[model samples]
Target: MIDKVIITGVSGFVGQNISRYLSECSFDTEMVSLRNSDWKSNLDGIAILHLAGKAHDTKNVSEGSEYFKVNTELTKELFNYFLESNIRDFFYFSSVKAVADEVPEVLFEAVLGNPKSPYGKSKLQGEEYILSKQIPQGKRFFIIRPCMIHGPGNKGNLNLLYNLVNKRIPYPLSAFCNERSFLGIDNLNFLIKEMLQNKNIPSGVYNFSDDEFLSTNELVQIISLVLDRKNNSIAVPKSIINGIAKIGDFVKLPLNSETVQKLTENYRVSNQKIKAAIGIKKLPYTAQQGLEKTIKSFIK
Candidate 1:
């Protein structure tokens, strides 16, 4: 029966939505500074939600060590305080990137691999540190690794897809078809409520994702339907698209090798562990349904 909650990083895209949800649910929510130099009065009989961390910079512009300074070091400090406090609930938001860069098959909880980016490595470091700590009988700790989370107010790669469809521009990378998983903010909120209410849910690493995987082609169709337009994407040859992406990388165009890979990748994540722990067979929203809501928000 967790009531009082303290959340860090309440200013982030995901954090803002989470704060609103908690308030509507009648939970006494408090926002804390991630840059707090002292943790003396921060923990009192309340649930702690650690969401402050350096996000992944897609443009490859941020300093590599900054990820460790915030994501790793800050997490270690706050988690240590949580263990000593009277708080019984602690939730750490991690990412699927902590496991692998490319998930050719289904991503599970215990798959070990080398992370390609500093962001993923820093998150993994935080996860390792949390797992090493010992928890008392009543206290609970959760390490959640969510997939590509998107919904209203998400101005990331999904916005790029919306722009292309809204303008009737040709999608050059239509040749590469693959399945990618996404976690809607709606489903994430639902899971958080479950974690707070149900003390039976054990503490461990869990992946958050929607029920089904949606392909890029399906996403394009969904966006076109939402915008009342036709998808004018052409099935450009694979070799030609690769060459174009290479040239774009050198010329600093919109389509680069890394962006191309992100747009068309086979990263499928399985949510069996999370659903099992939550005692459900399906998430609250399907992949296409969640994407439809996100597209509507874009037009709003």
Candidate 2:
């Protein structure tokens, strides 16, 4: 049984969620920022869950170097500190973007990773640095690559879809057939607890996601069910939808081409390895149930 843990990036979304979840599990957690300050005093015989670093800016306004400075360099700094300490497990939170930006098929950790964005590249750099090191005896390292995460606190793109459904607006891109995977925050919490306790789980790269994949169309239907509204998805043609999304670019409309691709993209991630490592066939919650819970949070 794990006794204590030191977590960085305690204020961010995942950080806040995991901190609270771990506290509920009755584990003592020390929260800290991933700055250049000396954080050794807090590292005395505690596990490390490094969740700090700049997140991807969907607006695309951030500089490329900023990703490296925060995601890559800061990770290296904190990891070096972890290596010097007696921390038993070091969990580095990475993204599926580090493996592949356009996942045309189900993505696994063993595949050739070719991330497209600067954010993905920087995260890949961090993973490589962590793997390049020689871990001390009796210490385990986990490089976690999770897909898009959502829950009550998430007000990202998913919320926009929920809003359209809630307001009874016609969803235009219903015709586009696609499959994407989303990770519920509760399932993520469960995975962390398993990783912390199961010493049988080895140290290496692991991809995290829900057991099943859901398309944007299915997502719309789920929202409609949760809101108890008549489904209003219009089967607009792909050409027309693309044309409107193109116009959205100059007019700054919500359903722009980029967002349309995100909504209709095929980015399915496989969670087989993590489950096998933890000795589980299925997660605690199904994709639909977790999504329904999140949709309810929107109403609250």
Candidate 3:
């Protein structure tokens, strides 16, 4: 029964897709980009989805402070403003890294948070700011912690893998066995829609991901199929890949240390909380299906 929705970071990948999805669902939507809009007016009778934040840039360590400034400080400013406004519901997008850099054997709601990077610390700070506020009557807050999200128009490391597979490039990390969960943009859209309408969902932190997980080799296989190419995978030793990454780092090549870690690391996030909240056992799309759809979009 939500009437109007306000989405921040409208120009970014997730923001754009979420905004478009909401519009198609017949909700009155207002798009707001941090660079273009001023939030002086009180937003009465509306739900606000805040997605604007400094994203992680693996190549540049100097930008870490900026991430804290925007993700933490800007979030504090916005929360203060919301306290004065009449907005009924607020949704904040955070990352799984805020909780842990490497997924442990078990990831639960009570796990200790020890963020390794400034980006993770900033997002954790934002979540803390919201939770510290005194709950007001008729107002609800949601802090969503999503794992690596992929879909059409995604520009993260997932895209690099897709492009490499599309060009029939041989993947050298086939020997490394790693499992990771990826969130599909479409499933996220569906979850948001449910959150806006369902009054029974309690205000709290929630984790989101595809119901199933996939290993790196399986992911590459999906990409190869989408590109209509025979899978070109090599079982290179992990030590050799690490040595090449070190060399690449010294030479300032595209495949640096960070990229190497990302390709071989296993970061599996749990989505049990989100499923319980939405009363669903599975998401709308499977991990492989969603990944194939994303890879196909890169072909054009």
Candidate 4:
């Protein structure tokens, strides 16, 4: 029975979602900011969720050093404190990008590749530091590498897609086929609750995602189904789309090459390890159900 927890980065999306979820589950949570120096004094809890880290800059405007300063350095600092404290479990929220930006196949816990971006590199450094240390007998450490996490509060590519569908704009990249995995916020909270109470689950690196993978076209269809709107996907030629993306590179347009690739990329992540460890055959919500719930939230 886990009573209390200390969480950092409560201001972020995942932090806010998890904080509220845990509170609803009757667990007392203490929100702390890593920017403060006295956070060490507030570690009177069963676990510490280190969620404070710089997010990926899609515009490529952020400095490379900024990634290290927050994701790598702060992680090392807080982890050092955890090493000396009575906190029983340490959960570090990492990204699948920490392993590879481009997944040629399905990603698992053991896949190792060079992370192209600074954000990926910094997160990998944090994971390496936590694993390099020898944990105390009673303390457990979890490194969670979640793929694209989406829920009610999230505003990202999904929101854009929903808006486009609402406006009756046709999806032009239906020609490209891709399989991407998504992690629902509810599913994530459920897994965390399991980890908190079940000490039998061993501590290690786990890939966090929904049980199934969905493609962008399928996502568009799901959005349409949720909105009660007709699917407006048009199979535009790949060559023409690539040419338009090339033109978009120099102009201020929505469909850039990067954006197109992000929409149509095969980045499937496996949650088999986590499910097996938690003794669950499936997650609480299916991929379509979770996505539809999120779409409904957008309407609200």
Candidate 5:
């Protein structure tokens, strides 16, 4: 059992939620942010879950260099400090993009990592650093590469979709067909807690995703269900939508090129390894159930 824990990026969405869960379970939790402050010596024997890093910025090209600095360089610094400080466990939250931009039709643990974006490359660099290090006796390290994580308070593209659906705005994405795996916050929390307690989970990389995959249309339906609105989606031809997105890009309109790509892209990550290691068959929530819960939180 972990008595003391240090959570980096505790102010962010996932970090804040996980910290609350740990605190409620009677673990002594300390919040740390990369933006400021020094660590207290009291964290000497604690387990560290590092969640702080530069998220992928879709709009800006220059932010790629910054991603490398914060994601790769900062992680190296923290790992070195943890090794010297006698920390027992170190959990690094990486993204699935580190492995692949678009999950192959048949995903597996041994897939060759070919990251297209700088965000993915930066995370891959961080994972490589951890893998290259020699683990001292009594120390365990984990590199968790979770797919698109969504739940209450998530402020990304998922939230934007929820807002549009909730407001009964017509969706022009029905023509697209893509299946993507999403990680619910509750399931992710369960896996993290399992890692904290289970010593047998080998110190290495693990991929995570929900059991059931949902297409974009299904996701929008779940959002509509949560909002008690009619499931109204138009099957706008792909060519038309693409034209609109192109125009929106130049006009600086709301549904710009980036949003269009996100809606149409398919990223289906596999979580078989994590399930086998943790010895679980199904997560606590279904795709629709988890999504509904997330949407309901926004209404309240």
Candidate 6:
């Protein structure tokens, strides 16, 4: 078993949770910031969890170059450093966005990556850069592409739904039926634990997500369940909603085209390969169970 692990981007939501989880699992963790100049000197761990990167900007305000600089270039730098270091295992937290912004069918590991947004393109570049390099003997690498992750303190699209439900506002896009996969923080931590302990798992790209997918309608119901309130959803016509979304594209309306697509999209990701490699049949938390935990945390 690895005695210690190094994690980057410790200030972010995923990094913080992973650090706490690893501590709970009796593994010492050290946080290093890539923004700092001397970060390379502090690499003292058996494994390096590369969690630092430029996050996808929902508002579309951030510069595209920023994504390449932080997501792509920084990853290359750290990965090169890892190649030279004594660390045996390196894990990069890539996003499913690296594969596709819109999944027509179930997304598997072998799907060709065709990212649209700058964020997705940058993440894909990071993955490609790592894979292009040749690793020395006795070293392993992992590129994990996780779907929408939710947990306590994560403020994203999920928070938007939660706030809408909390305020008794009816979900407007229920008519546009779609299902999306979600990655529970606990499930992610569980996978990391399995990978760290088990030596048989191969080095490659893997999708990290819950076994089941959930629709926005079901998600509203989940929020209602956690709040102990009545579920109120409105099936607004898709045409009307899309019209408003187009208007929102120009205007600063809450129901923009981007938000609309995010709320209602078919993005089912399969985790079979990772599970088979890790030798696990099931994750510790179910979809409903994990969603409920996240909703309850929002309430508190």
Ranking by lDDT: 4, 6, 2, 1, 5, 3
In order, the Cα lDDT scores of the candidates are 0.88, 0.90, 0.84, 0.92, 0.84, 0.91
Candidate 2, position 292, lDDT: 91
Question: Of the candidates shown, which would achieve the greatest lDDT relative to the real structure?
Answer: 4
Off by over 4 Å in 4: none
Tens digits of per-residue lDDT, candidate 1, 1-300, equal 548888899999888888899888888788888676664574575588889999989877999999999999999998988887888899999899999999989999999846999999999999999999889879999998999999999956798888998888977777889999988899999899889888999999999899998889888889999999988888999898899889998999888788889999999999999889989988888888888898899999
- Roughly what TM-score does model 5 have, to 2 decimal places? 0.92
Per-residue lDDT of 81 in model 3:
72
What stretches of model 6 exceed 4 Å from their correct place?
none
Candidate 4 has which clashing residue pairs, if any? none
Clashing pairs in 2: none
Worst 10-residue lDDT window for candidate 6 reads: 150-159
Residue 153 C-alpha lDDT in model 3:
87
TM-score of each: 0.97, 0.96, 0.94, 0.97, 0.92, 0.96
| Model 4 Cα lDDT, one tens digit per residue, 222-286 | 99998999999999999999999999988968998888989998999999999999888999999
State which candidate, 1 or 4, has the greater lDDT: 4
Q: What is the lDDT of residue 36 in candidate 2?
A: 39
- Quality of model 2 by C-alpha lDDT: 0.90
Q: Model 5, residue 143: what's the lDDT?
A: 91
Per candidate, the number of residue pairs that clash is: 0, 0, 0, 0, 0, 0
Off by over 4 Å in 1: none
Of 2 and 5, the candidate ahead on lDDT is 2
TM-score for candidate 4, please give it. Answer: 0.97
User: Which ten residues in a row are the worst by lDDT in model 3?
Assistant: 36-45
Best by TM-score: 4
lDDT of 3 by residue, 1-300 (tens): 658898878888999999889989988888766564566565545688999999876655656789889899888887777777888788989888899988846455556678998899999999999999996888889999888888888847787887777777898889988888888899889999989988888999888788887898998888887788899999988888888889998998777788877887888878888789889888899888888787777877
What local lDDT score does residue 251 receive in model 4, on the 0 to 100 scale?
100
